[model samples]
Structure formats: C-alpha cells, structure tokens
Target: MSRDDKGTISVRLVNEALLAFTSAALPAEQLLHQLGLVSVDLTDTDARIDVADFSKLWRRLARHFDDEFFGMNARRMRAGSFAFVCRAAMAQQTLDGALRVALDFFGLTFEGFRGELSRSESLAEITLSETSNVPPLRAFSYFTFWMLLHGLACWLVGRRIPLLAVELRCDEPDYTDDYRVMFSRNLRFARPTTRIIFAAEVLDLPVRRSEQELHSFLAHAPSNILVKYRDTTSLASRIKAQLREVPAEQWPTSEALAQTLCVSGSTLRRRLADAGQTYQAIKDQVRQEMATLWLADASITYAEIAERLGFADVSSFYKAFRKWSGTNPGQYRSLILRADEPIASRFP
Candidate 1:
C-alpha cells in the first residue's frame, strides 16, 4: 500500500465483526446505512475504509451491544470501559507508570489473561503473557488491547512513542494492505505471543496530559485511538527504516525515497520542512548509524566502511564521521568498547 493509505483500513478488519452482527440476525443493510457505509456488502474484505468511518461504525456497535468489545465474549465490557481506563491512566505521572496502570487495568478486568512490562537496554516492551480460556479472548482482543496501551501511551507522553515493531501469534491476514500504510515501521506475525515493541526512550517520557486534557480525550474514546499514530515517524525516520532493508553500500536518493513513499519530491520536502527536518540530515543520521555498526566490527577497513556508507572517498567519510561524532570512528568505537556498550550505544 502507499503511504497515504495508512490512514485507511482494509475491510477485512470489519469482516469478522460484521459477520458476528449478521449471525445475530441484525438487519445488515440498515446497520450499514446507520454506520454511514456506502457499500452493500459488509464482507468485502478487499474494500478499504477511512478510519473515521470505521471508528463511527465501531462506536455504533459498542453502543448497540453496550460492550466495548462488541460481544467478542459473553461478558459485556460496558461502554465506559475505555473511559474508566483512561481516567485511571491519566492519574499517572509518567508514561511508564501510566502503561503499568493500563496493563493492570486490562489484567484485572479481562480476567484469566496476563500482561507484562519488560525492557532491554534499548527497548521497552509490552506483551500478553498468558491467554484466557474461560470463554477465550479472540485474536482481535489481543490487537485491541495492544493498541489501547500503545495509543494511550502515546497520548500520555504527548508524543508518538515510536512503536518500533509488532509481533502477532496469528499469520498475516488478507486485510493488512492498510497495515503497510502508517504502520509500516515493522510488523511481525506468527510469533509465540502478541507483543508491541517501543523505543526505550518511551519509558522516560513524562505524561503531559492532565485532568482537563483527559476530558477531551475521553470524549472521543476509541475513535482517537483507532486513528493511526502518524506523528511517531518523521520522513527521515521512515526513510531510515527502509534503508535498513536496502544494501548498505548505497542508500536511496531523496527523489527515490519520496517515490517509494508515493509522494512527490516537493511534497516530501515540504512535509519534512514542516516537521523541521531536512532530507540530508536524515540521510546523514542513517549513514552515521550504519558506519558506527561497521566500525564496531574492527575488521572492516575504514575505506570499506566509507565505501559501504556511500561516501565518495575515505577522506569524505572521515570528515563526515568527525562532524557527526565530534571524534573519529575509531575513537568512538574504542570508547564504546571500553564502556562495553554495543554499537547502538554510540547514539542516544
């Protein structure tokens, strides 16, 4: 899917939902009209939907069943379930604290299931540690809960926390053409457990929300959450994610990267400019990170690292490295080696 398509969702996400409603013998046509749907077939898995439309449909369903989970189970997860969690979460002073509260909220309310908070030196992760069987939570439950926490986490911190990756126990579904939209950062499927990986900095981000803000936030409920968190990525960062997939010896040019994201050169530049970022700055950052990793090896020659990082010559690489690190690559490597930090430690 193209970048702009990130804001829309595949109808596949709604197929199970529509079927569940249809099986219950709801008048499908009337229901579709009520939800502002244009199409007659609610089961069109290939059709795409604007997230706003999807959110409206979701709210209608939630109110109809009085279950936020849309009868995914016998339990009625009342309409206020999300609001109550938000109220509790808003009290926390930091994203870390708020995340814990949200997780515990799910654990206590969604019995038999367990969730966890963990961290590596560079990542803060949340995972569903156990599954429930009392009535069994469906796979969609896992994603909803994960997204709730991720979205709320972003809301709490007042910034996108850079959700780096997602791991799912189920295989990639047919409806995920939209997943590549804004969520193209990283998506993994058929993993052992459902998980969301966040950049470690998220742990320390302070909760910028307040009681006043909570009111506006709660007023929107799941709609605000359903919308993809777009601010989490900059054009440069998006490019960097793509760069990792390419051969390090060369990186995509600005025009090429813009084309890859399906935007024009001017549009990309204008958007990046709006974000106070420049393409060159992003390119340099990607190059720096790659160079640091190569230099950490201690086997690759400086010239080879230079060549691979796309430098015109060893001297140019030296100049750029010095500008980036305030020290030569060798010294940066030695410092990290002495400190016993990985190459990634070179950057914040």
Candidate 2:
C-alpha cells in the first residue's frame, strides 16, 4: 500500500473507474481486452492492474472521446485542455498563485463543477462543489480530480505538499486501502464537502519547474502524473529505495533491515502496520516494479527476469507476477508491445 509502490491499482478501483464508461454506454469489455485485461480480472475482488496499463486506459479514453474528464462533466474538457492549464499555471510566482490560476482555469472550463482554493489561519483547503447543471460526480471522479490537482501542485512546488486530511462527500468505496496510499490515511467519508486540507505554508513555496522541464513532463502526460509525485519521505519509501540498490536476492531480512534503520524488529513491524504495509509487501512491490520495467525490454527473457528477481524458477515468477498484476508477464509484455504508442517507450 506504499505510495512508492505505484506498481498496481486495485480491481475495485478499476471497476469504479469503469463506471464512467458504463454510464456513457461505452464498450467497457472491448476496452478491457485492448488493455490485456479479461472479464476474469474484473471478477476477482482482490485483483490488481498494472499502473502503466491504467494510464494507457486514461489517455486512450481521453483521446477517443476528446474529453479529458472522460465525459464526466456536461462541458467537454477538450483534448490539450490540461496542457493549456499547465502552461497558464507555470507562469505564476508561487504555489498559491499557480493553484489559483489552475483552479480558475478549471472553474471556467467545466460547466457544473468548479475548484476553489481558500485558507484559514493555519490550514489551506481546496474544495470541489457542483454549481448548477451537471449530475453529482461519482466518488471516483472526485478522487481523480483531486489526484490531478494534488499531483500538479506538488510538481509545481517541487515537493510533496502533505495533505492534513481529505474530506469526501460520498461514502467510502471498497478500494479505501488504495485511497489511503494515494492521498492521506486520514480520510473522512460522508462529509459535508469534498476538499483536500493541507498546511497553509505550502502556499508560499516557489513554483520551481522550468519551461524546458514542462515539455518533457507534458510528453509523459497523465501516466507520469499518475505514478510520479508520491511522498517519498515515508519510512516505506526509504526502505524500498534501500532495497532497490541491490538485487532482490540480497535484500535484508526484516530484523536486519530494522537494525540498519536503528529500530527494533517489533517496532519496525508496528510502524509499517500503522501505514498499512508489511515487510513482505514491500519486497513484493519492489519485485513487481522491477518485473514490469524489465518486461518493457524485449531482450530480457522470462528465465533471466526470474533469476534477477530472486525467484527460484520461471514458474514461481509467473505465479508471483500473476498475483501482483493479475496477468502473466508474457501477456503483460504483449499488451505493452501492442499499444499503438507504448507507454514503456515513452518512459525510455
């Protein structure tokens, strides 16, 4: 559940996301197959989809529909709408100014819903409200809006603007665990309004990304925005980074890792438990991320990937990959290769 482990998204989340397509009477099953996901994947409540594929789904829908918001709003968010917003915000002097500019753009662009930024003495808030015409947005749409705004705010200031808490109006959905990892763990569902609360001082942080960096950033688009900008200060992120410096076979035992971090094994377990993570989960996440990254390279054989990931054999790797991504590694690779413009190549 660590943010650093943006390797897979829950099947529950995928279902919630598909609600948009279903509501619009779009062909959801065909889209799933195009992304190498089968009906069986949706049937498993515990299954997960590779994050890259999920991003592809986002872009595919956006381009074909010409609505970046996935037709969730009455007014279409035209293709390249987000890019224009980014450009407008990039000229602002501070995070506060940048956020206001972006929020204003969204306010004018979308017909029914608008984002507003306000602050009390100690805390700042970004609240989303339905103004007039459109139907109330689903919980998934609200969260997706927050993700884009929050992610962009972090990138603008070149830091993770920690959320004090998140207030959602809709009832908490089944994939609450994913929400905990994506936003703050201190989520309040069935609240009066849907807004993100954070410390006011972040408003003063300078907008640090330059025009040149913005080009590359936009090139990656929604995929980069989805997986990047996680709060890396978490203990899990630090330990995951430590694990990545060596082959997975050489990763330390839980007790040994705790000792290195200058804590007792019991304390380490307790701390990670508080964060909804476990030692084995972290290891699996690291392995899963590496597996997908390596699979992007056609030269790497299944046996080689297995050996490198510290798997005993190819069969074991296949089982673990299936568990992690809900698809075999070969099928995953085929999906990537089949993408009209593969997301893997974009990263390279």
Q: Report lDDT per candidate.
A: 0.66, 0.74
Residue 128 of model 2 has an lDDT of 74
lDDT of 2 by residue, 76-179 (tens): 88988888888888899999999999999988887766777876554567877665333346778788888878878877877666564576767877668767
Residue lDDT tens for model 1, 181-279: 334335656655566654556677777777888888877755676663653344655676788777765677889888989999999989988877888
Which regions in candidate 1 have their CA more than 4 angstroms from the true location? 3-6, 27-30, 33-40, 132-139, 180-184, 231-248, 255-268, 275-277, 280-348
How close is every model to the real structure, measured as TM-score? 0.70, 0.64
Model 2, residue 341: C-alpha shift (Å): 50
The reply for model 2, stretches above 4 Å from the true place, is 2-5, 23-26, 34-40, 132-136, 231-348
Alpha-carbon shift of residue 172 in model 1 (angstroms) = 2.4
Candidate 2, 96: how far from true, in Å? 0.7
Query: What are the C-alpha RMSDs, in order, of all predicted structures?
Result: 8.2, 18.2
